[model samples]
Target chain A: MDIAILADAVERGERRAVARAITLVESARPEHRVQATELLETLARTGREAIRIGLSGTPGVGKSTFIESFGLMLVAQGLRVAVLAVDPSSKRTGGSILGDKTRMERLSRSPDAFIRPSPSQSHLGGVARRTREAVALCEAAGFDVVLIETVGVGQSETVVAELSDVFLLLLAPAGGDELQGVKRGIMEAADIILVNKADGDLKATAMRTCADYAGALRLLRRRPQDPDGFPKAMTVSALEISGLDRAWAEIRDLVDWRRAQGHWHARRAEQARHWFEEEVRQTLLAQLAQPKARSLMQSLSEQVADGQLTASRAAQDLFASLWPEMEQTKLPESLDATIDTP
Target chain B: MDIAILADAVERGERRAVARAITLVESARPEHRVQATELLETLARTGREAIRIGLSGTPGVGKSTFIESFGLMLVAQGLRVAVLAVDPSSKRTGGSILGDKTRMERLSRSPDAFIRPSPSQSHLGGVARRTREAVALCEAAGFDVVLIETVGVGQSETVVAELSDVFLLLLAPAGGDELQGVKRGIMEAADIILVNKADGDLKATAMRTCADYAGALRLLRRRPQDPDGFPKAMTVSALEISGLDRAWAEIRDLVDWRRAQGHWHARRAEQARHWFEEEVRQTLLAQLAQPKARSLMQSLSEQVADGQLTASRAAQDLFASLWPEMEQTKLPESLDATIDTP
Candidate 1:
């Protein structure tokens, strides 16, 4: 619990300290939250950073396989690797993506690699928020590369991208129609698209899919953040491990290009600003997410859904219900109450 | 200022009252906002409802022309109609979509039709939120149909979809690749895709484009909220005033189907719930959007951006600054401050 000692241990890359710090960040207890903030603030002074890569894939697209192979490869090169999964839908699916570290057995066993499952079991927004903190913890612990993996559920992939310097999309070999299923926001967010399972029978199919996306990417006017021939699509095979080296090389090239263009620092700063703003917004919303106010919202929403009350009227009533709570706060008198106490 | 009188006037379909109510909703003054909430709540009791059709098209796609023609046609049918524009990009573009009444002069002058431009010039979120209230005002004023038009900017169209009973997408004659330029989120949010400018030499090309999108729609699995043939694509010539009848008929058919399937009420209830929750969240965020808190956030964000402070550290400091403000409120002491004074 000693902030300085824990930060020093994290800087020395002590695995226990790293795990404990991550656990601290994940805790929802008020006192723990205070300590977590203190710990993070202390570690921030260390100024350590890692290549934060965000990886997203469709369900059953071999995401775990990809991360395992990818993490192992990084660790083998004498780089400490951390794999963190962010699955906001885990509670509903009853299958946490990284719940069984055995999925990444080899990587988990690697002394140079660290693996963690999704932080919160539910609350779509909080899972990704907590994962962002975990990524910072990994960076402070001296990891050379941190792979943040997320399934294409809700907005997890987009949230993961905010925590990452590089965003990678892993897709299975599919036709154009399947490509249409991919949300364009995520496609535009990707720095690189990898058509995975590109070996054996599906090799040619994966190549064709890659070509389709590559062509699509080519048609996209160059984003100011990226260089030419960048944001390109390629095929990869996690089982055969054939295309990873090239993919890694391409990632390095993109990172190097970005750094040379001074975009690396600018981008990190922008991401930092984004997260700070997001933290502020999320804190505000969390007030309403608390048990008392949530029940009131639910009851009022039921009235709305039943046509017993209009949405506006229900909203006004709820807003009025929280006035007493707002009165005691130094909030501007103009502040409108939202979360209602039971 | 009189909530009951205004609600009564609105229900009577008085144009002056409708416009005044909308302006009240748009005003950010504390007193005006309180009055607006009261008026909306009173109006909600009337239970008057209108079909809200969301319309979206790329700039230069003749959206205004389409709306004008479409609005005139409905007016000709003796149906009372209201046209509301939600343009979040108005400030930057310096050209609000419905700013010039001359753009839809004929429709505007029609006794049965009313047109109002975008409410907020900037602040993307507030524009659409205010427009939702405006739509409610229109509905309470006994308009049979309300057309919500938005340019393809940010998430305006998506927001419009939530406020609409049926969502329409208007597009110029273009190839399959151009379709790729359309965000898939908007594409899927659409109920019908109309290939505008389907007259003149572009007729055949429009038909081809229509066929291409129709084919794509066919490839998509049917959304449960829609019928089998719905969300299909077709060609329409807004200039020629042709195809408007068919489009209206298709919309009625879709509405009738959804109504019979029980999805219509369910959808509205869900939208109400969504808006209610959004109001709560937006209220919380509004606290920071105030002058003092916002300036603090800006300065701290600059620090984070300049790398003079880590994002977490800056966020922590900002959070700390907001605490004294929080202590005055009955807010659960759980809220860490997130905004600071200069």
Candidate 2:
């Protein structure tokens, strides 16, 4: 696997090569993971640029329809688009129903659009990790715009929001009273809220829902980096294709404003730091799941569950077992001082 | 230093002993942590049964007033009440204003009540861990009702929700439109919603707010373990002490219903499991903060922040350095199967 050659082909907008690269990155095999890292290093050096967007909504919110309409509009404007999804539920349900290629039939057929459903078989973190790598790949492949979609309303939405430059949440007109049904943290993460399915019979409801959301949003604390100072809510009909142009304009304005303010670069840097800490934490847990440690943890868990051992004590014992030297070695003076003070 | 004596005194309901035990648990010194764990283990063996409740609200919601009024009512019914708080802000602000002894003037002076403000200095998780231990100490001291209050809103409320049996979210009468200001996840965690400060001029507004909350809660999904199926909302006048008795009855009903249906034991087991995993993660992070690992992480973080290296690669390099054996060692067969499947 010559990563340099693959990186070169991906840079030249070779769709097949991009797909193969994504598959390699998503593989759980140890050797493949090593190679994937090498591939990413090469791709990173190419300095690919793309406007990344994260989109999310609850089930039955016309997320796929909205993405299809939104993606086609971008492609029509001569901007190559890529749609990637992060659906961890696919691991449990066997595959993602939300990001099925058939759902975006027209977008998938477009020459300027690349659609990749979530890697159907991975942990939530694994799926997020792969989706992030796929975003880099799409950028390297010369796609000017990349949209990352998440299914349902929970941590997946939060994860997508963190990885993308802008987060758009799709809601249906009937979701007005159901606003409470959506997680507040998810709503806060949205840079823009689009009331989808705002056509025909639902138009009146959608308009009312739009007003309700606007009022609701005003009461919430605004994100400091918000280009408009607050999250914007608007009505859109994915089926009728109304409001697509205005939506694009808002997204563009937000990106341009954030870039001008230097928040775009700062946010990416913060994201990098966040992923670093997350990876370190996950890697530590994986090591702990090894056989020797697993057995020890099991017994400790049983004791703790039975109220015979405290969780803190169990963790301390496991740490001692994993690294015997650490038990006797005191923290360095500099770090020790901070810990004591804290 | 004498954990046995402290444990015995705590079991005998000595208020001073209970306070001293909590202080020992909250200590950052490694030696004190060991003794605190020992004390908890002994206390656990005594089979202390108490109905643990977590109460949270944003600042200005009158959490202390409600708790004071509510606590005195329970004490009048021959119940011993203990109020413990988890406030990480205290570490930054130097002390908590939410759980200050002065805030609950009447309750603090009661012979049957014990009030412990959050430790003035500690991390969020550190405070939560200590507070959990304090809850056990309170139970050992024969308190039948333990109230764990969290200041303001955010992760602290979620942490408190996880540690308690029932979570009650208090709000002011004028908080109807401000509903969107509250985090959605926190609202979902509530087992009961109490509209406090409902008196005189605010009485009608509180009733309307209570109805609004009830309607909003109906739109949200209920927790599967909730004995009553959905959270109930009601208005209360803590200042006038009007709804204290009814609130206690509702709490008692929920607890009794859950215990009868076996959800109480199951929920506790799940909470224990969650804390076990949390402790393991935190302990690993602490170990990584040690002098040797700290220097390596700092350098890697700088590279990651500068965009010279991807977070994934940096984490891999760190993990390889920390556990060289993991690089070559295949996971144990049992764990390998699970890892491969995931």
Candidate 3:
């Protein structure tokens, strides 16, 4: 119940306490939000100097396997690692498997690694909200690095891009034709492109795929002020733990380059702005769903559907009947007078 | 210009006049909206009866080519066809090619077919809005079939699905693994999936791809209420018009089956409800962007970004600052008491 004490424990690098803090923040209770805010503030003061990385791609691209290998490598280097894996929950239910632990069993057992899988609440905003908060919690727990992984479904990639310093898009070894099938916008957003499952028979095809991707990358308008110097293609076998060190080296170099260009700070600031706007949009939607407003809107909708009234007219009527009255009661005399004077 | 006069002309099967009327509705002027409402009122009284079809797929999926051959085939069937193609627009300038006429050159010259291409506006709502209104206008012009072509992308498919009776998805044959990679959500939403460009050297590959897709379709959960039975996979060469007749036959069957099962009316009713919700959401977003609220919110955001205030506290402050206090020249206590009681 005492969030301050729990937050202090989390800030002191007590692993179990940090996990507990994350759960409290993730709780939907109003009281939990108050407690979560306190925890975040405390954590913000003493969070780790971790390099946060985001990994995203189409589903079944072996993201879990890659994260597992990458996290194990970091642990082998005598560094602490944190993995925040997000999975979108079924809309009918507010829960998910939270299954990243099962995929990263070895790394999950390591003393220096922490793996947390958070359910992506129905909307993109919900997922982004918790992930950012969880990252802060992990950092506060003194993890040397944070890896956030999400498959390229819905707006998950965009959410991950906003929260992390580096974003890696894991592509399968499909050729140019298949690559062209994907929306260019998603491809353009990637900081690095890693062709996954590049071992065994997929090796030759993977190299060809990499070449095709590299060629396609050239045709794309160079990213504006790209901090990664130049985007490079790499073949990696997450299943075999091969070519990962090179991938890690490339990620570090890109981060340092971005930091030098001040892009790292700039991106975080942009992310904050995006979060602000998204919160406003979401909260406004929630407010509109309040009982009185919702019932009236639904009734009018039924009428509109039955051809009793047109849609635009119904909207205007709702505005005239409800909102105008609310506005009249809301404005102070001084404010009204100021408007008249103007 | 009198919209009622325009509507009357369109109702009388005046094609040029109907096109002009739609242009007016799509205009960004207050007077145009007033005219559009008058036109809609007149058209609504005419008892709309038209088969509205939605076609969507990723770019380079030969959408235009398919529509061209399909529309021409419908024309030959003694049906008047109207094509509404929504193309992507440049965000900076709001300029677009409106190139369907060029792509569907044969259809453009056909006496029984009408082709209109509109720029997809910056707002997805704008695209949905204009497309629906245009369909209504085309119906008023005595077009029996309205084919709406939308660029396949996030949320666009959902938008297209809401406005049409029959939905078709065009897919490319990526390779042997193509069936495995395609998103099941899109496939499920489709009433028919057409493997386009299934001729020339691509013929053998196309047949194989079709078989794979057909096999994959079996694995998906069947819609319990598909009156035309389950969704089917078909291969067509949009350029050569091969299998054009079969695709049209399938489309016609689905539309008739939907009408017989009363699915048509229910779909329209559901669409109207969705449209109503979308309008309210947009209105709330606009209200937040109003000068007073925007300024207050901006100030609060700066504080939150600087870490001088918690987000929750900043929100309360913004809400308080934006709401006008209205304790003006007092109403008579009797009236005030009466109003308060209500």
Candidate 4:
């Protein structure tokens, strides 16, 4: 693999090269991981930037329709769009129903549009890592916009929101007051709430739902990073393609405002730092899963469960076993000595 | 310390010994920690079982009043009670308003009651570990009921709930519709929702609030482990010392039902397992904070923030450096080998 050639091809907007880059990053092999890292490093200096948007909705919320409509709109305005779906649930089933191109036939045919489904075999953390790397690849491939879509199940939406500049939550208009259906954590992470199916006979219901959400948002604690210090709510009919432009405009305004306030850059930096810490934690956990440590941990866990050993003491014993040198060193002064009454 | 003597003293209901046991567990000193573990192991087989309950509410929700009133009721029923307040916020300020014995003057003065404030120096994890150990100590000291109190300010409440058999969420009646003020995560964790201060002119409001919460709970997903598969809601006036018996009855019923269904024991086992894993992770994180790993981590973090290196790659590099033998060994088969595209 010629690193320079691959980087050049990706930067030149070669579709096959871009897909290959994503596949390489998503691979679980150690050597491929090393090469993927080198490729990312090589392309880091290219300075290609993309607007990252996160889209989420419950199963029946028509997330695919909205993405296709909104994505096509962006393409019509000459913006290159890439859609990356992160479906962690598919990891267990080893099949992703989300990435079928037939679901968005028109958008799939557009030369300016690229849609990639989530990797079916990876865990949520692994999928998130791949999605983030794919975003970088898309940017390097000259895509002006990257849409990260996720089902509003489990913590996948939260993970998607973390890597995105803007988070859009889609909801149906019926039974809008049933806010309990929406996890408050997801609501808090949302920057914009869009009431889908606002056209046709659902218009009145959609209006009421919009008002309901607006009231609810007012009662919620304000997000410090939001430009207005609160999330915005609006009604949009993705079927009719109505209000899509306004939604896009709102997203743009927020991006500009946050960028001007220096929050955008700061948030990205914070996210990067957070990802680094997560990687370190995950790697350490994986190391602890080795046979030697795993067996010790299992026995220790059993003792702790049976109340025969304290978890902290067991942890210390395990750590000492893993790194014997730590046991010989004097304990740090921060550890209170007076407590040893003997 | 004489582990056998201390364990015997704790089992004999000696308040001073119980307090000393708690102090030993809370100490960070290496020798004290080791001794504390031995003391705990010695006391582990005493078969002292206490009814553990977690109580949480927002500021001004009358948590102290409720607990004081409720604790007195339990004491009147010839039950010994131990109150462990976990206020992580107080750790930073080196003061705990929640555990002020003055706030529960009557209960604190009772020989049947024990109240321990939050430890002022440790982080939330440390405090939680100490509190858990203290719970065991209190049980050994013949306290038949343990009340774990925490402010619903952050993830601290979640930690408290995890260690308790039943979680009670208290809320004021005034903001009934403003469910946004109450995080859904906490609401979902609650086994019983109490509308505190439901007397005098606020009786009607409290009733309405109780109804609202019941409806909200219906809309929320049921916790799988709950025997009835849903949390219950009620109105209580701590100031008037009314409804405390009914609340206790509700808690007893839930505990009995969960025990009969075998979920109670299973949950405790799961919690113990979780604690062991948490301890392992926390200890490893502490190791990473040591000077050798700290400097390298700092440099890697800077590189990650600057986008000069990806987090995954940096983590791999750090792990390899920390365990040089890993570099020499062939990558595990679980780590796919096919990703080396070259």
Candidate 5:
């Protein structure tokens, strides 16, 4: 695990080195973490960049088929494609289904394509973090496009959206007015929504669903980051392989417009800062995760639940217990907590 | 200023003492906070309880009219009612409107009613926490009901839903199928969706909207907490005062059912624990809010944004810089962060 050698091979676009780099970043081992950071920092100096597109949909939404078609289209145009999945379901099931290469047989066999299954991650944050580093690795290895896929579930799409330049939401045909096709809270995060299975009998229904979402998107708050005519919906049949080119064109138009408006650089920088802040918060919380502190918190929670103590008082008690040396006046700092804008 | 006298007065349902206690809890001053905590602890021992109903709707959805008519109805039935508004907008606009007493002139003048304007707090968390304390004060003052109304905006409704016993979502009519009448994610948080303005020529439209949401809610996964026919949609008109009694009956049915199932106590305990955990997290964040630590974070954020360091490495560097005495291996505890179930 020579960091310099691995980084150099990754920079040279060697397949084995790229695979090994992703594995290193995904490792939870402390020694592997040290090497992974060094490797990422070394690769960062290479100054390579990629189009990071985040894709999400419900469980049976043909995500794999769409990715296969889209990845093959990009590969045909001489663009190197990398696909990564952020599925938190693996943490609960002890299994991974998304990003399965076997599901996208055609794209998996392409020389210009690289597909990795979702890591059996234990949480949304950990999975998203590893996938983000893998995206950086792909960029260093000269990939032109990195498609980050997240299964539509609790908070996963939103987390993946933070690391993407553009986000696509895939859907099946929605019923008239029910519009209950997609999960709640996700429409706001999607820049482009594609209604899949649009061929044959479902074609007309898909068209109607597209129009319905298009109308809903128009009524929702318009994001300042998007160019005009964006956050729109369109029909795409992955089975028919129709509309893929149009979707790609719209994606390019969006990326180009954001780049021209200076939003492209600003967004990535903001996302990086967001991750940094999240990591910082996690570090701070780790102190309370200690065994003694956790047991104390559990007892306090039970007492507060049983009405023996108020929530605010329980928090104050925990603070006192954790740090008896600190002054009583400092125990409840949130009473005077003030936000400082940066 | 005298805790014993004030607690006694509040327990006796004295108006002046109740108002004074709320102001004390809402104060950001360190001294007032100490007194507020002491007063709350004393009030807790009294064991007075009130039904907490959280109401949310888009502005101009006739929330003021509805609360006025509903509060008057309850007062006419020999029940005291307290109305509190949680408005984060006041933090930005420097103007309070939601809970203005004048908006519900009739109810405000009634001796059996209490109306408090939204506090001009600086952020969502602080505003909600203060409102929770105020609700406690009202309960101690012998109010039979506490109506917590939050203007439908951003994440305010969801936070209020956490504190509510039975959550109500007030929506206006929708078009044939747009369903864009309410906020995106707030629907699932609702236990009841009341189609307001169901009186005029718009009455037919409101009925249709109610049916649409009824279908949508059916499609949503049932919360194990709710019994049959719950999380349902109904049409109500505060202007006509026609549906007030029916809405009241439905609310009572749901509350009674939940109590019979033991969800009432469980829900309250869960809410208290939630607030306790939130307070602890805020306390942890306060440490990083120190001037020196803030400056360090800003520098690290800037470096990560500029791509001078990866987000993870920057977090590692911050940990090392913050605690030079601590072992490097011990600093990145989140690498092994595990969710410990209680």
Candidate 6:
């Protein structure tokens, strides 16, 4: 229950203890999260200097192969690598499959590599939050490089980008025409684009696709952080492992470029702000689900649906009806001011 | 301003005026929606019997063409038809570059057929509340065979199914492994599968794809309703306007089967319940974004992020803090009680 003790253990490079500490933070138990948060604060104070990179692509895109080759390169350079590969389907029933440990078989067996496959909970955003926390845990456990992999579909890219310093979007060399399938909003968010499976029959198509992407990148605005960082589209074969060195080199170049321009810290700070807002939104929404509040909403909804009243007027009535209960405790001034405001 | 007056105009078959009125309902303005909903409710009472069918497919699957051809067929039968097509990109930014009106050039010119295209909105739910209201308007306007065409990607299929009695999934014969890309969850939800573009070089592939889908359907559980109704997969050429009659016939047969078993009304009732829940969720979420509440959430978030608190405890604190004001309004206990059960 003592988070400070866990923090101490995590700071001492105790791997098992660090993982356990993260598990505690992720625990739904009220008491455990409180203690884990305190431990997180302690870890934050130590200032973990890990290079967190995010990798995402469509399924069967050889994400595991790429990560394995890239991670091995990091180990070869005398750096400890930690991979947090998120399997969105693994936890369809609210349980962790821990399949990343199996999928990244070679990486998991490596002494320098720590691979954690996080469960995608009922909320994908929750999975992202817990993964971010685990990243911090990995840093406290002495890993210098952290790679987070996510599913290519839906809002996973945005979620992964929230916790990463450098975001890399992986693509297949399905030809330039297939690029239309990628939503522009998601494409705009990527810092790097990799054309994977570039060898064999895909080689010519990969080159062409990469060229098309490079051209498309010009139509988009340059990233705010790295004015010099052009979105680079490169071809690589994860199976052959030919471009691992170049990929790692480019990533480091990007990190250095971002750090030199002060964009690295600025982005992290922005991410922290984003994390704060999402956390508040989720927490408050959950609170709204409390029995009494939910019942109030349901009845108000029926009244609105039955044409007896307007939604805004019903909201006003509910607030009026529940005013006494709301006024009981003196909330923090910031919160109080917000609630008090019309 | 009088909804009853608008309903009267709609019932008199004022097409342009009714179209404009439906547009107003889909508007974000509170007053507009209030007026629009009132107009829709009045129309709901005197609704005509419309063969409401839902059509959903991936982009470039010729959804507009299918609707146009289908609408023309109904018009040939001396029946008026209404086509409501939803374009997602148009909804988000309130703009449409690829005009569906222009795409359905012939249908737009039809005196007995009405075509209305709605843009997708910021709401995650594909069909807007106003879209439902517009359906009622079309019914009041004396249009039979209301065909709702929804974009292929995302959860739009489920949203479209709520407003229509029959749901159809359109597919392109995509290579030998055509079914591979069709997600299983979505396939399970479809009532009918129609392979479009089934002509020229694609005819053989389309037939094969239809056979594959039929085989797949056999392995799945029989639809809860219509035990006698076979889930048929057909090949059609929306462009050539061939096999559409057969598709329509099958649809009518399914609808008739559902009605005979009394599943049609039950499905609509369930949809009504879903609409109620969705409306409540949207309303409550909007309320939380009120200027004051947002600021409070922001402040609370920072404190939580700083490890001064856990999210669960913070939520409890927020609710406990707001209790007095909520209690003062003297709302019924049923609000909270109802929420607890759903």
Candidate 5 pairs with clashing backbones: none
Which of the CAPRI classes, incorrect, acceptable, medium or high, describes model 3?
incorrect
TM-score: which is higher, 2 or 5?
5
Worst 10 residues of 3 chain B by lDDT: B333-342
Q: lDDT tens string, model 6, A1-342?
A: 556667787787666676676566555444555565666767876776799998888887788888988888788889998888665555443234345666777777888887765643435245555776788788877889989888865667778888899888888887545787776776887788898888888889888998898888888988676556467778888888877788788888988988998888777766766776665455545544566767887787666655455433454456456433222111111111101100
Cα lDDT of model 3 overall?
0.72
Q: lDDT tens digits, residues A1-342, model 2?
A: 777777788888888788888877777667777877888888887787799999988779998899999999999999999998887766433244343778998999898999888764655256567787899899889999999999853478878988999989899886556777667777788888899988999999999988888888888887778855458899999999999999999998999988999999999988878878777766666666677888998888887877777787787788888766554222222112111100
lDDT of 1 by residue, B1-342 (tens): 467777787888888788778877776655666777788878877788899999999888899899999999998899999999887776533254345577998898998888888753546257656888999899888899999999868888878999999999998899777878777788889899999999999999999999999988887767999897888898899999999999999999999999999999999989888887776666666767666678999999998777676555676677678644331112233213231111
The per-prediction CA RMSD against the true structure, in angstroms, equals: 6.6, 5.1, 9.6, 4.1, 5.5, 9.6
Model 3 over residues B244-293: C-alpha lDDT tens digits? 89888888788778778887788888887787677666655666656677
Model 5's DockQ? 0.31
Kindly provide the TM-score of model 3 when superposed on the true structure, using C-alpha atoms. 0.71
Superposed model 1: Cα runs more than 4 Å off:
A1-9, A59-66, A92-100, A169-261, A303-316, A323-342, B1-12, B42-46, B60-62, B92-99, B171-183, B192-237, B250-263, B302-320, B323-342
Rank all candidate structures by their TM-score, best first, as comma-separated numbers. 4, 5, 2, 1, 3, 6
How well docked is model 2, in DockQ terms? 0.28
For candidate 5, the clash count comes to 0
Better of 1 and 6 by DockQ: 1
Best by TM-score: 4
Fraction of native Cα-Cα interface contacts (under 8 Å, chains A and B) also present in model 2: 0.31
> Judged by DockQ cut-offs, is candidate 6 incorrect, acceptable, medium or high?
incorrect
Q: Which stretches of candidate 2 lie over 4 Å from their true place?
A: A59-61, A73-78, A91-99, A171-261, A325-342, B73-78, B91-99, B174-237, B249-261, B325-342
The runs of at least 3 residues in candidate 5 whose Cα sits more than 4 Å from the true structure, single-residue gaps closed, are A59-61, A91-99, A171-261, A323-342, B91-99, B171-180, B183-237, B240-246, B249-257, B323-342
Q: Tell me the TM-score of model 4.
A: 0.86
TM-score: model 6 vs. ground truth: 0.65
Poorest 10 consecutive residues by lDDT, candidate 5 chain B: B333-342
Question: How close to the true structure is residue A325 of candidate 3, measured as C-alpha lDDT?
Answer: 36
Stretches of model 4 off by over 4 angstroms after superposition: A1-5, A91-99, A174-193, A203-236, A245-263, A323-337, A340-342, B1-5, B92-99, B171-188, B191-195, B203-237, B245-264, B323-342
- Poorest 10 consecutive residues of model 5 chain A by lDDT? A333-342
lDDT of 1 at B97: 34
